[model samples]
Target: MAKPKAKLETLQDKEILTSELAAIVGKTPQWIRQLTRDKVLNQVSRGKYNLGEAVQAYCEHVSGGKEEEQKPRLIDFKTRYEKTKAEKAELELERIKGNLHAAADVEWLLSDMILTIKTRLLGVPSRVSTECENESADVVESVVRREIETALSAMAKYTPDQIGGDVSHGGPEDS
Candidate 1:
């Protein structure tokens, strides 16, 4: 006598272990577990899944079915914000560069003006000696020294107004 075997149901909708489902979906077993935890994919048992349903659910999630519209808006806003930030940084850098060049130019001009003033002051002793030439050499030397000392003292006390660069006085026509 032969024992008869009962036929199993068809395997199209069969349950599969998580590792098997992951292999079918080309994903890690841990990813299958995460989907089950997030309720994106349903589990058939502690470590099993309905392979067909899991694949469908994962497809829907990856497609961003209900959130597609908002995603583009978020990406666009981030791009615009980064572009504006870069433009503002560039403008600020240009302004700082301009300020540095202007400061350098002002410093150069002031240095040149100071050198010119020093050259004029050095000529004073020769001019004074010539003017007092009728006197004895000792007296002329003493007078020149006294005159130069007086001029140097006056220069030390001089404000920009005395030398012609005062802004507040407006112009020579104002005097």
Candidate 2:
């Protein structure tokens, strides 16, 4: 039988001096003192130190595992979506207000045109044609009215399930 190998003893209370550590690390003792002064290495007892713990701490520092170098947590897409939706809602509200103002102007223009037509029809030279010579205004007004009707029809078309409401609505296309 082969002779039993000698068991190695664990070093629990073993320590090294600052000069010894500097010699092992191939640095000056003054540099070790600077490390201690910078709090990179804690002084356990005067100049004596735990070389194992110091090496481990130095390794961690050089490897960039220091607490201050941790990455910040990132925000997820759902939060970004909610933020964008809120901004879109604000913009939509402004757009609706502007549309309301424009609708008021259109109503005023249409009212004024109807009043002029009524007055002209009531009292005008028989030879003079009261009918508008320019069809562009009528065409524009008709186009606007058609677009508004189409939008309203689109809104009306949504069923309760589609609109998240109670009534079953049909669009012009459905009709």
Candidate 3:
């Protein structure tokens, strides 16, 4: 398939195709289209442009005469960069101050506590089965509850000391 070319309205007209303009301007056709979109270049038709006017516009665009419009964009970029840098620094300081713990450390702490409680609960039946067999129902129940309470009490005495430098990624240290 072939596309129809735009007809020149008059022999005196000075229009050029996108590719011709790009070649003369030392840029890609896409670059020409972008400049046109940015209002730095003008098109005489959908894919044709006035060669002299397009070149003049491109020269003006590259001459820094458009600095006023670009300064806000530059300032905005620098502002965002500084803000992000400050945020990262603040987070780092907070982490070093022991105000935050790594996810891995928290995960380890919970897993350790759960395993301890599970072990304690699993041992209860074996340790109290014979004693419970001879005791009253109330006594048996009290024994089981006491064992569970002891296991739970271990969690109440929570301490981060155990999450020491032993972790693969060094734990937060106290100064």
Candidate 4:
């Protein structure tokens, strides 16, 4: 006995049910219905579908195939400019603070030297006595002068410009 040949029918513009689509896709009928309900697959007609459109929609959903939306980045030109400006201001403030500390140290050293010389001169009893003794006065004056000269020379070697300002302040007019 011989078997009969299968007939080939031309497809028409029509709709199919979930069971028929599941047969074409080789999935369970219930899974096809779920996909339709989730809108991953859309119905072209009631209880029917287009095979090509269904496959396209399923591929798009599974392949991370959404159109990319452009978003603005958080870091822009204005933000960078403001950050750089802040860093520069902080550096400048540090420099000014350093200069102020240096000036204070210079003033402190000058004051300490002046006080030491004054104390030494007062220790000479004859110089502080009621009688104006010429010899004791000369000795005190000579010692004070030598000490002031040494202090000024040391200052000039370390900070010439500052010492020059002090020297220019108390002097006769230069010819």
The better candidate by TM-score, 1 or 2, is 1
Off by over 4 Å in 1: 1-11, 66-175
| Position 107, candidate 2: lDDT | 46
Q: Model 3: which ten-residue window has the lowest total lDDT? A: 166-175
Better candidate by lDDT, 2 or 3: 3
Candidates by TM-score, descending order: 3, 1, 2, 4
Local accuracy of candidate 2 as per-residue lDDT tens digits, 1-175: 9999897744533588999878977889999899889887777799988867877766664554464535422233456778999998887786666532334444444444455455544443331223324457776566545554554554455332332111332222232
Clashing pairs in 3: none
lDDT of 4 by residue, 67-158 (tens): 45563323444577899999988877865665323444455556645665566555544333433445476866675566556555644554
Model 3 — TM-score against the truth?
Answer: 0.51
lDDT of candidates 1 onward, in order:
0.67, 0.59, 0.77, 0.61
Per-residue lDDT over 68-165 for candidate 3, one digit per residue giving the tens place of the 0 to 100 score? 75364444667789999999999889778877767767777677778778898888898779768879989999988988888889777767655543
Candidate 3 residue-pair clash tally: 0
- Report clash pairs, candidate 4: 16-48
Candidate of highest lDDT: 3
| Residue-wise C-alpha lDDT for candidate 1, range 1-175, written one tens digit per residue | 9888887755646789999988888899998888888888888778877767777887877665335644554445667899999998887786666532334444444554555557667777787768777778888878767766765665465443233324343323243
Q: Look at candidate 1 and give me any clashing residue pairs.
A: none
Those runs of model 2 whose alpha carbons end farther than 4 Å from true positions after fitting are 1-9, 65-175
